[model samples]
Target: MVIFGVVQIIFSQIPDLHEVWWLSIVAAVMSFSYSSIGLGLGIGKAVEKHADYGSLKGVGIRDVFHDADKTWSVFQALGNIAFAYSFSMVLIEIQDTIKSPPAENKTMKKATTIGVAVTTLFYLSVGCVGYAAFGDNAPGNLLTGFGFYNPFWLVDIANICIVIHLVGAYQVFSQPLFAFVEEWCSSKWRNSNFINKQYTVKLPGYGPLELTLFRLLWRTCFVIFTTLVSMILPFFNDIMGILGALAFFPLTVYFPIQMYIVQHKVKPWSRKWLILHLLSTVCFIVSLAALVGSVAGVVARLQQNYKPFKTTY
Candidate 1:
């Protein structure tokens, strides 16, 4: 995690999301690398070993809490799924990076369609195959779970790909946040040199570049703050579940549907309105359940003597 923070600190200095287009490409490649490896390993295990391993009712209680009933695990699984698909929350920010000979929104829509389809395929394949391979004993983490221990070097490569992918994913999600805060602060303190000033410096081979004292300090502090938070609540999947549950409903579903209704000026009690509201309500219920389950998972972990900075890898 410290290594993650350090890498983030360096890339977070890149100033803008568009500046890290190469990073995005690299991260996407790393994502495919690991996903393919995981999917391939699972397929190999299923074909070579017990081809018929899983039960129809899903795996036993081995995901996080072995003693808890299936309901909590199923609810927590909802949150995990939400987290996996929550990358759409960053789509608007990402869309701003597109080059525009074609209409940007049109391009974004097409790209999003492809991206979602591809990700869904990969995620479902990797997940179902892994479950089939290990049956009731599948670990929460695929590559890092040491489930594919025989191919140590390949597993190692997949893990490394995960690390690289996360490094870029962190910045992809964070740069917009940094921008928001910096823009707000600059506007709030319009004439303050410390807040609004940009400094130009020449790098050894990179030539002149602009820097800001406030950005340097504020972004660094922000990274440190989030790093500390991660260390404190190191329940990776549970934390993801919590964040996913919190962000999924409003960001991913509700707001867009509401905007569409308003833009189209749909009648308040029409079929469209009724359908949209019904969908929103259902999503809200799912999100609420996921949040509760994930929180329970965290509480359960805490009861098992988990401590900050003391958890063994």
Candidate 2:
């Protein structure tokens, strides 16, 4: 994912999304293929009842409530949900990628609806089928649960697809972050050659660099910093939990509704305004709880002296 972030930064430098939209399509297709495969495998396993594998042996809805001390489970689940549905963060940017004025909003709305519906259905099907196949013994990652002994080729294909999809996804999501940082730096260094139009600098080792040193410095540093952090704290679930809790509500729920209310000039005490505010308040509360729970989980894991890349089980 971190490597993908760097790839995203590089691709984001391209001025037009239309030029690179094919990559996104390819990623989407790959994701759909892998997810479908996973669901298919789960269903097949459930039906086959292979002797070595305990297929359908423990098939039932797993108990939801865990020990009180294991609050991390709840938070982790919330994080996963938030992460899955968090595409709202990049919706506006995606919409901007479309050409034209009148139909863009409608098209974007339709696309978003379809995307969400399909993603939700896929997730639900995969989760249910995997649960039916493995019951309480399912691994955190569905792919990981399918060990090397059984149909290893499918696992390999799924993993490869995941890698390809993430490469594109990282670029799609990280572009906005890169743009924001670049804009900020441009504003701060107004006189710099990088921000100035028609300004180029010549270097001894390399021929004329188009932008100033600041651009390369900041962008490279940002990628390096994120990469290092990812390496140091490679707990995917925990990190996803933290990010989702911290970002999902504000980015996905609160800001969009708030912006709409403000744009429409809704009366402060009006029903629409009141309802939106109430919804935002609820999201805020949930976000707070998730943040606290995730933080506690991280601290607990740290206290255990958990090492990255090491399997606990």
Candidate 3:
């Protein structure tokens, strides 16, 4: 965990997401690498002798996982699924950085459509294949939860690729948050040199990079605090579930619908407005359910056996 945080801290120093465009490219490749590897491993497992044949409907609602009600499991699953597609918060930030010969929105729309479609398909394939491989006994995290893959060495490689992919994803998702806080601080403390001053340091393989003492200190602390919390909690899926459920409806569903209504000037109570609002309401319900279920799961885990740093995946 320390090493992961340290690596993130280093990448976080790159100033902004725009400055490290290559990082996303590399991260995308790493994502495909690990995902493809997992898919292949799953296929291999499924074809092997005595392979598990899972139910088409998956685990029942009355089923139990780790002594928790399957209803909560359903909720957690919804949260994770929602989180997988919740990129709206960072989507605008990325679109803002595009170098446009053509229109930026045009590029963004094309990218967004293709990106989302491709990712959704890949995730579905992975989930389906993984479930088929392990059936009802499938682990929460197919990659890490597996006791052993037939070719364990490939698992190690996949793990490395995951770390690399996350290093980029962390910055992609977090840069917006960092930028928001830093900008707010700078505005409030305009006269404070500690917050306003910029220092240019020439580093090899990079141009005269502009940095600030406050940026370094603040970003480092943010990484440290988040890392510590992660280590202490020893919960992965539940935390992701909570974050997903909390952010998905507001950022991805509600705001987008509201924006569309305003941008298109669709009259209130009109067919389009009604449809959009209806979609948003259904999403809100899903998000609420996910949030409640995830929170309950976390509480259950805490009560059962949470060893913090001592807990192993």
Candidate 4:
């Protein structure tokens, strides 16, 4: 993850998503391949009646609601799922990459519909097959559960694909944050040549350079900071749950609906206004619950003295 973060920071210098569009395609293909491999292996194991299969024999829909004595786990799971579906946070930024007359709304709607449909199918296949293969003992990451001695090469391939996909995905998600920070810095250092796009910095021993030292420095620092945090708190699931809860409602549910209500001039007491507000309120409650659940989970883990930089599986 740290390596990927550094790679993302370097690639973010490109400044235009369209120029790196092929990266997204490659990442998508790698991600799909990885998921497909996981599903196939899981189903194969189940069908072959591997030793683990007996554990899953009684699994059913009811198992989905079981929480292993952790009442708040369901909320954290919901938060993770919500975060997975919350691309609205970056939708507009993605649309801006399209050529004008943008037709951005129409294009974005079509893209989102297709993306969600495909992602849903993949998630369902992997989740169901994995659970069927290992029951309540299913590993948080399917790849990790596969021992190194069995199908070692295949496991390596799947893990590699995941790394490649995450490399691109990190860039896609981090670009917005990079842009936000850069804009703020530029605004603050208005008199700097770096902010003026002329990059006039020169050294006594070297010729003038077009490089923006401040931009490079800040972006590098940001990547280092994130890398340090990842190293310090490497609990992937817990971190995902926390981030999901913190971001889901505000980014995925609230802001979009609020913007639509305002844009359409939906009046109070009207059907649209009432419906929108109702949905927002429900999301708000869910977000709060998820937040509490995630915090509690983290605290419990800490109390247990869980080791950092170690794989939970």
For TM-score, candidate 1 versus 4, the one ahead is 1
CA lDDT scores, all candidates in order: 0.86, 0.73, 0.86, 0.74
Writing each residue's lDDT as its tens digit, candidate 4 over 1-313 gives 6667768676655554565677878888999999988887887777764536534244344554444425566666676677785567667788888775648778888889999999999888887787777776777688776774367888889999999897777777777776787788788988877554645555555445444766677767877888778877766666787888888889888888988988888888898888889999998898888877777667666666667766342
Tens-digit lDDT track of model 3 for 1-313: 8999999888788788788789889999999999999888888887888778688777765566554478788899899998986688889998999988799999999999999999998889988888888898877777864546668889988989998998888899889888998999999999988887999988887878888889999999999999998888767889889999999999999888888888989999988888888899999999999999999878888877768788654
Cα lDDT, model 3, residue 203: 89
Report the Cα lDDT for candidate 1: 0.86
Ranking by TM-score: 3, 1, 4, 2
Query: After superposing candidate 2, which stretches have Cα over 4 Å from the reference?
Result: 1-19, 50-66, 194-212, 308-313
RMSD from true fold, candidate 2: 4.9
Clashing pairs in 2: none
Better by lDDT, candidate 3 or 1: 3
- In angstroms, the error of model 1 at 143 is 1.1
Give the runs in model 4 whose Cα sits over 4 Å from its true position. 16-18, 51-69, 100-102, 148-150, 197-210, 307-313
Q: How close is candidate 2 to the true structure, as a TM-score?
A: 0.82
Q: How does each model score on TM-score?
A: 0.94, 0.82, 0.95, 0.85
Better of 2 and 4 by lDDT: 4
Cα deviation in Å at residue 269, candidate 2? 3.5
Candidate 4 local Cα displacement, residue 57, angstroms: 13
Best by lDDT: 3
lDDT-sorted candidate list, best first: 3, 1, 4, 2
Report the C-alpha displacement of residue 278, candidate 4, in angstroms: 1.7
C-alpha displacement of 254 in model 4, angstroms?
0.7
